[model samples]
Target: MATLEIRDLHVSIDTDQGAKEILRGVDLTINEGEIHAIMGPNGSGKSTLAYTIAGHPRYTVDSGSITLDGEDVLAMSVDERAKAGLFLAMQYPVEIPGVTVSNFLRTAKTALDGEAPPLRAWVKDLKSSMEALRMDRGFAERNVNEGFSGGEKKRHEIVQLELLKPKFAVLDETDSGLDVDALKIVSEGVNRVKESTGLGVLLITHYTRILRYIKPDFVHVFVEGRIAEQGGAELADRLENEGYDRFVTSTPVA
Candidate 1:
C-alpha cells in the first residue's frame, strides 16, 4: 500500500518572459484504493499536474514536492519513478513503429520485477487482458499504437496499466477521443485492474461521461493551475449541470 502526496506544487514553463508558473500551490493526496478525478477547462493546467507528477522533463518544478511511499519523486528520473511504482498514461499515446506490444510489455515487466515471467504464463495473461478489452490477439504482434484508432490507442494504455500494475497511476484524458462503447470498455478495464491491484488513480478528464461508469472517490475542479473545488461523486454531477463558466471566470489564467 502506498500514498501519493503533492504539496504546494508549482510548475513553470520556459518562455520569452522567463519561467511562467502554471501550477500554483496545488495540493493533492491519493492513498491506496482511491480514485481522484481532476476536471478542468482548456489550458487550466490539468495536464501539467499529471505531467509534473510523472516527472516530465519539460515541466519545471519551480517549488514543491511529490512524494510516493515516503520517497521524494521529483529527485528521481522518469524511469526511476516508474520503477518506484508510478505510471502515467499519456493523453496522446505515442506511436512506435518498430516496437511490438509484446516486446514493450516484456521489457517493462522485466525492468520492474527484475526478472521476466515464464513465456507461457506471460502470453496467457496478455491474451486474457486483451480479450477483456475486446482487442484482438494480433494486437500483441503489431507495433505499439501505430495505425491504431483513437479508441484502440486508449485501450492500449489500459492494457499497459493492467500489465504494469503500478502502485499509483495517473491517467491523463484516457476517456478523450473514445466513443460510448470504447469508453465503457476502457472504464471496465480500469475498474478491473484497480479491483485486482488496489492501485491509487488520479484520473484527469474534461467531461463526466467516464465518471458515470467508474465512480470516483473524489472529484476536483482545477482552474488556473490550482484546485478550485473538490467533493464527492455528486460534485461531478454538479459540474455537469452548471458547466465550468463560473469557476473559469473566477480564476485568472495568468
Candidate 2:
C-alpha cells in the first residue's frame, strides 16, 4: 500500500512583520484506504498543511520531510506532485478564464497520465460523473469555475476527484458554503470515490456536519499549528459537543 508521511514538519509564511510559523513539528502518516479528518478552528493552519502538501510556494518548509511511498515529495514541483498522485481540492478554487471545464479536465488527466485519455471513454466518464454530482450538462461547455456559485465550484471539484482517481486527495473545507442538500450530494461523491478506488483522504474541515457522511477512520484535532489530539469518530462527536476551548490558546493566523 502507498503511504504519505510527514515528520517534524515546520512551515512558515512571510507576513508584513516577518516570517510567521504556521505548522510546528507536525507528524502524520496516512496509509492507503484510510480517511483522516483534520478538524480545527479557523487560523489553526489546517489549510496551510493542505497547501504545503500540494507544493504551494507561499508556505516555506523550514525543516522536516514529506515522503510518498519513500519518495521525496518536497523535492517535486507542484504539478509533479499531482502527477505523483497527490490531489488538492482548495477551499477557494480559482477560476481559469477562457478554459472550458471539459478541456481543463482532459488536459489535466493527459498531463498526469502522460497521454490523453481515449476520447470516447473520457466523454462517457465526464458525463457520468457530472450526472452523479447533479451538475447540468451545459457545465461541461462553460469556462472552468467562471460565474459558478460556491456550491457549483465544489461539485466541479468532486467531479475531478472521481474522474482523475488520485491515490490521495486533500480536501480543504469542501463543506463550507454548501447547503444541506449540496453537502450530502458532495459527500456522496467523495464516498463513491473511496468505495471505487480506495482513495486515501485528508479531509480538512471546521464543522462536523460533513463528518457524518465522510466517516473518517481517524479524527485529528489540530490546534496552534499542530495536532493536539486524535481519536476515532467519537472524538468528532466530542468536538461538536464541547468545542475547541481546551485546545486553543494565544493568537491564531490564517
Candidate 3:
C-alpha cells in the first residue's frame, strides 16, 4: 500500500569548504508491486540515491522531495520512515557485536508489527525462512553480521526482508562480493519475496549478473548522478555486452 515518489532529488555531503553534491536531480516513482533496477558507474550516486530514500542521516537533501503514500518522507525521522514501510538492504551490512540475528530480527518484527510475536512462533518462522535461503542454523545464534561471510551477510539481509515484509525495499548492491551460487540463491530469495509479498523493489547495482535471475520491470542507466537512459530488461543485456563507457562518457555532467 506504499507508493514511493521521488522528485528531482538532489543530495550533497558536507565538507570543510562547503557541500559537495552527489545526486543531481533524480526523479523516479515506484508503485506497490514493481521492480525498478538502477545501474550506474562507480561514482554515479547509485548508493547515494538509495541511502537518501531510506532517510540516512549523512547525506543532506539540497532540493526536491521524497514522498511515501502521499506523505513527505524527508520530514520523517529514520525510525519513522521504517515504521512508514521503507526498508533498505545496505551493501555493507553492519556488524552488531552483541546482537544476535534472532534478537535483532525479533526486535525489528516487534517494532514493525507493534507487538512481539511469541518466541515459539518467531523461531518457527525464522527457521523456515533461513532454510529457504539455504542458511545454516548456527546463523540465528551468532551476532548479527559480526563475522559472517559475504554470502551469509547478504542472505541475512534477505531474511530480514522476509521477516519485515516491507512495502518498499531498496537493495543497494546486494550482489556485491557474492559468488555464482550465492548470487543465484540471493536472487531466488529476492524473487520469492517479490512474488509472495507484492513488495516494490528498487534494486541498485553496477553489474548485470543479479539481473539474470531476477529480471527487472524497468532498467535505468545512471551516469554522473543522473539517469542517462532507461529501457526494459534488455538494457541490462546491452550494458553487459557494450559496457557503460559509451553511456558514461557521453552523459553530460550536472
Identify the candidate with maximal lDDT.
2
- Please, what are the lDDT tens digits per residue for candidate 1 over residues 184-253? 9999999998999998999999899999988999999999999999999999999999978888765445
Kindly list the per-residue Cα lDDT of model 3 for residues 1-254, writing each as its tens digit: 76899999999988797888888889898998899999977878888898998888899999999999999999999989999989999999999999999999999999988999999988999999999999999999999999899999999999999988999999999999999999999899898998998999999998888998888999999998888899999999999888788877644332
The residue ranges of model 2 lying beyond 4 angstroms of the native Cα positions read none
Model 1: colliding residue pairs = none
Which prediction has more favorable TM-score, 1 or 2? 2
TM-score of 1: 0.97
Q: How accurate locally is residue 237 in candidate 1, as Cα lDDT from 0 to 100?
A: 93
Among all windows of ten consecutive residues in candidate 2, which has the lowest summed lDDT?
A: 245-254
| Index of the highest-TM-score prediction | 2
Candidate 2 overall lDDT versus native = 0.96
For candidate 1, which ten residues in a row score worst on lDDT? 245-254
TM-score to true structure, per model:
0.97, 0.99, 0.96
lDDT of each: 0.92, 0.96, 0.91
